[model samples]
Target: MICAGDDDEDPFPVEDCLFAETFSQDTAFTLFGQELRIQQVFGGNLGVAAAVWEAALHLCSYLEERSVEVRGRRVIELGAGTGVVGILAARLGAVVTLTDLPLTLPQLEANVSANTPSSGWPATLPTVLPLSWGQDHMNFPSDWDLVLCADIIYLPETYPLLVRTLAHLCKNTAVVYLSSKMRKEHETPRFFEECLPSRFNVELVHLDGSQNINIYRASLRKDLSQDLD
Candidate 1:
């Protein structure tokens, strides 16, 4: 069933251990004059996926203040666990595609539908699809202006495939934005530098505290690895 919560309620009980395990809710997040309702898949408090989405929303608001128009852009968010970022992008006027592994698509779709824009707003909401990082290339749209991902790089096995998928799917002008909480040795930037030399242009734009999560703008360019020393 669909769980709902008001603005002031923390719904998840931090005190009780058992009550925190199974319940999930659709929470409302407001920023930049846009009210986005997102679904928390695993219940309790906001998980790591939603936390990263919160950070991404903050960054989006920061950019919006600087006159960066997020509206009417083609955006794709990979590994969208709870579909928070992509759904927010749609609410802000972008045509977004939210994708994750096949198993996660159902919940993702529910989140997308739960957070859809109002009637007077934009007509097209985000499209939810099944896209495994390196496995399935089942008809993705070309010429995307922006690609977003959050908290997907913790697993080292998926590094190469992630880079290659970004290279193949994103256009030359496409900006890839990613955020993650890395372990002590699992630096996502290092993974990008190691794998992106041959096919894409990689630049580290922002790094959060503790050097764990980072924002990168990866664009497609020729001979991008010339400076990979």
Candidate 2:
């Protein structure tokens, strides 16, 4: 329902727009037993990426409920948007890197700074970086324990690039956890059905039928792993 881009011609679902307006500049969320204050920028050139999506919250809940082992792990979040999921992972003791497009970094950085503690965790603090999928993915280290993505597969044009980036980042035992809303208009199924399976063995670990959101766990295919080596 959220508009994908800043184009005037882009279709903006009325219900989604109304939902967006319900938030103030800063919204608070309780995840992983901590309160996080996330700043949201609406109706800008940033589009839907500036706001915290339902998929991000659902992913956070899944991680918390499943007791995912992120502690002391090398985790990176792509298309981080409001930085909620990555920040939550950091709170859970992971060395997290939150990445998004160049324009989205400022807000993302702000949210990370506001939510993340100044110090005291055994793990390294979360870092923020700008990563455009496929364009500069090679600049990043291929060695990661976990790759987190939330609501990033809406744009079909970026599907191949996203898959390529995932294939590169998920080396050895690295796993990817992606949460997305099943919006038919955005062709959300195509990324899971076609793009991701091309590089990784993807599984639907959880599904929230009420919200139409899905959480997928993916790992590099054995064949692709051999090819990378």
Candidate 3:
């Protein structure tokens, strides 16, 4: 699906891949029965945000297994590095949006454009936008069927903002599929402390052979984020 690291996925060097000024020529993968080509950029051009992480691959497989549920749904993939998960959802007929930091747009747009099935590019090409965590809340849509993301919790400090951002962007009824490779053990509990049993409901999504990695399914308990002043 979306392979980059070995099975015991070590933390990717974000400083090198995201902050280093460089370019990696396009690479292709078969995800959800469709092939995708991604053009990766690093350094000033882009960051770790442009590389296809291993969690993305696992998420792709997970989504493919549930394609029937995905079709015709309103989906958004945030922190959409290289757009693999979002593109996969689009391939399955979901109306999808791919969101990431502003710089990743070049690569995100390129990957979606080049890999879209020839017969359905216009309909399948996703809306690309910048969705910085914990920042502006006005730009994002309030309704979503599913919000998808992978390997987004590498930075421990951003966990609260990420949870808050999700609460703000998704409807109380929406589902969120978030996959995280445990780069730092403390990070997840920190997230839970910030989000659980209060603003959102969360559960572990067990997948075969991925004991170290976790796929968490979260949904808002109530639309309490809007009450913030």
Candidate 4:
């Protein structure tokens, strides 16, 4: 996604992205070649961390196309609403950990279990957890090979901590894939400016199948990285 303050090219513009569809809590969809069902909570009952946003759709498709490279990797997905992106990663053969706010865990777990049922699911079903960005108490395994986040840069107040969390967890051997709708200009630029140049190399991915959403691949910079303490 184009950072809000960025003057660079806004590739893949979404001229008609204003109109979005509403779905029932339980719905069926296909990602890549896999057919899956998910349960999502919406309306007043759903929090920002629980809604199935558009960015995840595009992220899942990209994962499908890059399935081979994703296989056997240990992935951690932040703000994993409805568990869609992580579920797709699990389908792509990655060991995935899907996380959201504490309140969102039940819903994320439901979708993860529903889509990857025990009958057909292998022993490696995705793990669901509560993770507030920048919170050190988040109980997750270390050494994540890949980190995925979508639509998380909308809040400016959270950007500093969010970027810190991203950089901290993704220190070594982490290829971070971030997807988000390019909105709230200030927040986006703050995220890129605070985190990218020093600790990671950011690459904009041209996603083919979505509107108003962007994909970025951030590889940790080994040479220039520091704890920044």
Whose lDDT is greatest here?
A: 2
Candidate 2 local lDDT, 1-229, one digit each (tens): 1335345442222223434443338899999887899999764446677688999999999998998999999999998988999988888789999998776787887887787665654587788898877778888988899999999888777788788888889876799999999988979998899888988899999998999999999999987875542
Find the candidate with the highest TM-score and give its number.
2
Look at candidate 1 and tell me the lDDT of residue 148: 82
Local accuracy by lDDT, each model = 0.63, 0.82, 0.71, 0.68
Where model 4 places Cα greater than 4 Å from the true spot, the runs are: 1-24, 66-68, 137-141, 207-210, 224-229
35-154 per-residue lDDT for model 4 (tens digits): 778786553234454456778887777776665367788888887767788887787678888876665677888888788754654437888776766665234444889898877677
Per-residue CA lDDT of candidate 1, range 1-229, in tens?
1121333332211222323575566777676677767666563433343333444654465455556566898888887777767777787788888887654666778777766555733737678887765566436754788888766765555667677678667644677776555454656556766766566767776666754555666776755422221
Clashes of 2: 0
Worst 10 residues of 3 by lDDT: 1-10
Question: Residue 94 deviation, candidate 3, in Å?
Answer: 0.9
TM-score to true structure, per model: 0.75, 0.88, 0.82, 0.79
RMSD of each: 8.7, 4.1, 5.9, 7.4
The better-scoring model by lDDT among 3 and 4 is 3
Cα deviation at 229, candidate 4, in Å, is 5.8
Task: For candidate 2, give the lDDT.
Answer: 0.82
Evaluation by TM-score, superior candidate among 1 and 2 = 2
Please identify which of the two predictions, 2 or 3, would achieve the higher TM-score against the true structure: 2
Residue 69 in candidate 2, Cα distance off native in Å: 0.8
Q: How many residue pairs collide in each prediction? A: 0, 0, 5, 1
